[model samples]
Target chain A: MRTVEAMLVAEVVARLCEEANFVLEENIHSAFQRGFEEEISPYGKEVFAQLLSNAAIAAKNRLPICQDTGIVVVFIDLGQDVQVTGGSLYGAITEGVRDAYQRGYLRKSVVNDPIERTNTKDNTPPVIHCRIVDGDRIKISLMPKSAGSENMSTAKMVNPSKGWEVIKEFVVDTVERAGPNPCPPLVVGVGIGGTLEKAALISKEALFRPVGHRHPEEIKAHMEDELLDAVNKLGIGPMGRGGRITVLDVHIETYPTHMASMAVAVNLLCCAARYKTAEI
Target chain B: MVIKRVNTPLTDEVVQTLAAGDHVALSGKIYTVSDAAHKKLVQYLGYGRKLPVDLSNQVIYYAVATPTPPGRILGSAGPTTAERMDDYTPALLGQGVKGVIAKGYRKAEVLQAMRHHRAVYFGATCGIATLLSMYIKKVRLAAYPQLGAEAIYEYTAVDLPLVVNNDIHGGDLQREGRIAYAITQGN
Candidate 1:
């Protein structure tokens, strides 16, 4: 059995927080570079350039790419065979997050309440989602979700009669209505066919996929492609100033759903898709 | 390049000279605050109490800064979304606040305040917190230390680059820039 200690876990979490906050993942960086070349509009291209420069400056300077450093979200794949030998996992994660936020100089954007807002300093107590996987390795994916794009995320329950056309329309309309608000040249993550909450979960999970990768399943892959094509057609462009590359990518992750209904969730990622992963 | 360090309650001469797309750096004294601090500041003012810091001729950057490790002057600090502060901006502007720096778009009312007050709203590049931190030469809290990142800290910067988004003469670079780029792109 693999044993994880509190101090070690805290250290891991701290590093994860710093990397996630400061650096743009290599895949995302490549995607932006590719987008710059593929973008037809001069405006679109310029926006892409600025974005790329911004990412580089952020990483080199070790600062957040956006003011909304985002809510710290951790997806932990813990091995069932592994044992945590040190302090509490939750406590360690929080402590690590605190240390990283302070030491790394990342913003502490988390608030205590949604309505009657109060801040929880240090961006502590990350939204931790742990899944016990089959192997001995523990994989941790840290995502800092900004509110601009996150606010536009939507989930809905569709009747069984509504077919793929409805799904396409719903997804397209969501992107169109979102316009430049989600910071165009966005990544659309779609979660189809699951219970309400599960669908939402899968939608966020889909965002973890590296840009340009498609679903392994043929049908879903085709659907994602179609969605991507349709979203770009909206011409939202970069920064909503209008352009051809409204969407940089579309990712879909699905789960089995109840016979009575199909639930769909759309999670939008702005151009600055910042995330990092680590294993221990 | 000439660098200017001026206090806020900005005058027409300062704001009129600024244009969108000009790469200018800010210096001198500025304060860091975000939504949480905004709320607290509003509340304090609502009760007819003096603010912990004076607003005259001062610029406020909408930011939630991470705390510095031991002995550091400050931590990674960057601008937050401007739209969130639309409500408080007018009030702050009315109270002799001169400049606001943030990322994202702002509403018309906020622009109107800038127009009326001869103030300028500057848009800093988002996600450039790391690069931006190098500009901060000094940092000290003015108020609300309990608010952590939301606390108001006086940041004396040198060449903190930003674009003038909304200026005193009702010029809004974001809207104009977006429109021009959209038309040029034919989208």
Candidate 2:
């Protein structure tokens, strides 16, 4: 078994936290440029311009892309043969998030409890999803999940027979209702299939897919294209003030699930679309 | 779009003149308040206690800025979702808060309160935090320093870009914009 030091994981997570907040993924910028070119509304074009400018300022000045630096969500692809040594893996990840928020001067937006809603202070206890995967190296994908866009997300189960049409309507409805809340133009990440929880997880995972990149499978990729076209047609535009380019892109991930269940989730990522992946 | 340059304290007369869909370049002292601070303020009001800051004719932004590093005017400061504070907003408006800044739809009750109170809702483009921070000419803690980022901070913003999402006359830019741009299936 390959032994990896826990402290290294912490350090990597810390770096990912800072970079993801400070940087907008290249594809996200490309989408913004694309949106700027195609957006019909004069105001919509302006929104895209502001977002692109915002990304530059955050990177050059080392400020977070958005004031809501958000709760960090880390997806860990842990190799089955690897052993984490020197400390608890969870603790190391927490330490990394804590350091990034403090040392990097990023906002600490996590609250310890939902109802009580007291600030956790350091933004520790990030929602880390670990999956045992092939290879000896651990891969970490980080997204500082903003509550503004996150609160606009939704998951639902529909009858398997009537799923396709229902899901399309559901997805469109969500974006319409979300409106200026999530800050369009948005990159919509969708997960279809699996149980409810699985759908939600993969939906978020789908967001890490570079904006505008298609799923590997031809059929699934086609679904993404179809959904993207439909969502953009909503005319929600940038900042939902209305125009073309309501969504920058739509990405979908699918998983096999119980025969009886047809669970779907939609996670709307704002134009900021901050995501970073590193392997260690 | 017609751009309106305005400064606070926004009075009833100034707010009444503004309308939805107007682009605004706002400057002057804007206070930050969100989530926890809203609860505290409303709770304080409930107890008939004098609030820490008088709300009359003030522009309050519904956002908590990130901690500022040395030599910067302010940290990344952007608006949060406006809907989350819908419950607390009527109270603030009742207390005479004149201008509100945030993104997203507001509750009907809050809209009614804005009309009754002669206030306006401005949307600072969500996720454009860095760009917005550039408008912060100065910032200082006003109250609830213990709430950290959620603490109320008095900010002097210059040429702060915003859209008049809701005006005291009950015009809603979001709704109007959507209606104008939403193409029906036949179209």
lDDT of 1 by residue, A119-220 (tens): 686777689998989988778888888887898889988876877888888898898777656766778899999799898888999999998899999999
Candidate that scores best on DockQ: 2
How far residue B20's Cα lies from its native spot in candidate 1, in Å, is 5.6
* DockQ of predictions, in order shown: 0.27, 0.75
* Native contact fraction per model: 0.29, 0.69
TM-scores of chain B, in order: 0.89, 0.97
In order, the interface RMSDs are: 4.1, 1.1
Could you tell me how far off, in angstroms, the CA of residue B164 lies in candidate 2 after the best superposition?
0.7
Write down the worst ten-residue block by lDDT for model 1 chain B. Answer: B178-187
CA lDDT of B178 in candidate 2? Answer: 74
Model 2 lDDT, residue A233, Cα: 70
Clash count in backbone of candidate 1:
11
How far in Å is the alpha carbon of A46 misplaced in model 1?
A: 5.3
Docking class of 1: acceptable
lDDT of 2 at A265: 95
How many clashing residue pairs are found in candidate 2? 0
